[model samples]
Target: MSAPPYHPVVPANPADADAIVACWWTLMAVHGPIDGRMYETVPDAQRVYREHVRRQIDASKGVVLVAPTPDEQGIKGYLLGGLGQRSKVYAVREVGMIFDVAVHPDHRRQGVGEALVQAALRRFRLRGLSDVQVTWSPENRLAHGFWQKMGFAPLLIEAYRKL
Candidate 1:
């Protein structure tokens, strides 16, 4: 088979926040079906999320990456990650946290998502992070398989109950 199309992953600028948020919502849509309660959103979610993305773009510890579409008109995927700290008691005080990642449906399985992640990992390494973590619903097959394939093993299991 021919090689998957190559889309260069680049650091996102403030202007890319809209596109990045769009991808985020797409990812959330996938998760919503898997578990509505777990992925519920507020009325102002888009606006709130857009602001969050812009803040990350400006934050020193944050890493926001995007893969531009083949034509360069828009982004095909995005990954949001950043440096995070655990309680001071932990030996691993600082860690890398991948907040979100999403590839447009049309671009799935073509390496866009992986490329975005790999780029973020490189950035994390540059900032002296030794551990990177991502959380996704266990019921989402695509997420489960993809993260596992990317070498992540369960470090914690979050249990939730509805009242």
Candidate 2:
């Protein structure tokens, strides 16, 4: 079968914030079922996320990449990446963090996600970063497998409990 045509991943602008937030909610829908406590969506998640996405787009150390739908009227996926620093004790100073990534259901398995990841990796490399990190819910099997397939391994495990 022929693969669906997809647009090249490109840097996002303020105009893309709404689409990215829509993609984020799509991610939450999948994850909320995996861990309700951790993925709880607030009543104003859309508004909050829209603001956050706009900030990320304007952040000097951040990169937001999006894959536009074939018609170019909307986005099929997005990736949020940024540069971060480890504690002074850690030798790795500058690290690339893949803050969030999501692809609409219709575009899944069509290379949209991978393309976003590869584009982010290239941006990190160009920025001289050798280490990158991403976090995902352990029970989100799709994310676990996708991140692993992208060559990311577990480096930290966050534990939690209700106090």
Candidate 3:
């Protein structure tokens, strides 16, 4: 049989920070064009994303997962999702939110993304969270199809404009 879509995903440790941050940079690069391209070139972009990952790892209300190469040579993918606030417009006090999910460009269509999301869903379910939400730009056709395939419904539309 062909090799599995990815290696076993596990809880990220302090030692995995560098690799994880690198993957975060890759993630930002991939979405930079689709989301907001200008900020992608900012010098401090990596720093900000690094701090964001660190906080997610430390949060008791969230989980950060990684899929490393079987030989541990490098990370193949990473996922970041956790408990987050709901605006006053929503009835729920909090919700399980998947803030980031990305697989290495070379590893796409290999089940890495789906597996990571499944793991995130299990984590949220274990915490008694019934509703899990994933946000993506409508302009991102890949995200539109993937999130929908993952059972995400479009409930919010956030628009932005430059003056």
Per-candidate Cα lDDT values, in order, are 0.90, 0.91, 0.80
Per residue, candidate 1 scores C-alpha lDDT tens digits across 1-163 of: 9976677999999989888888989988888888888689999999999999999999999899999987877899999989898998999999999989999888899888888888988888988889998998888888899999888998999998889
Query: Candidate 2, clashing residue pairs?
Result: none
Report the lDDT tens digits of candidate 2 across residue range 18-136. 89988888988888788898778789989998998899899999889999987878998999989998889988989999989999988898889999999999999999999899998
Give the lowest summed-lDDT range of ten residues in model 1. Answer: 3-12
Runs in model 1 lying further than 4 Å from the true structure: 1-4
Question: Worst ten-residue run, lDDT, model 3?
Answer: 34-43
Model 3 off-target regions past 4 Å? 1-6, 35-41, 87-91
C-alpha lDDT (0 to 100) for residue 161 of candidate 2: 95
Cα lDDT of model 3 by residue, 16-135, tens digit:
777887877777776778757443467786677777788878889868998888888787888888898778888776778888888888778888888888888888888877888778
TM-score against truth, every candidate:
0.94, 0.94, 0.86
- Model 3 backbone overlap count: 0
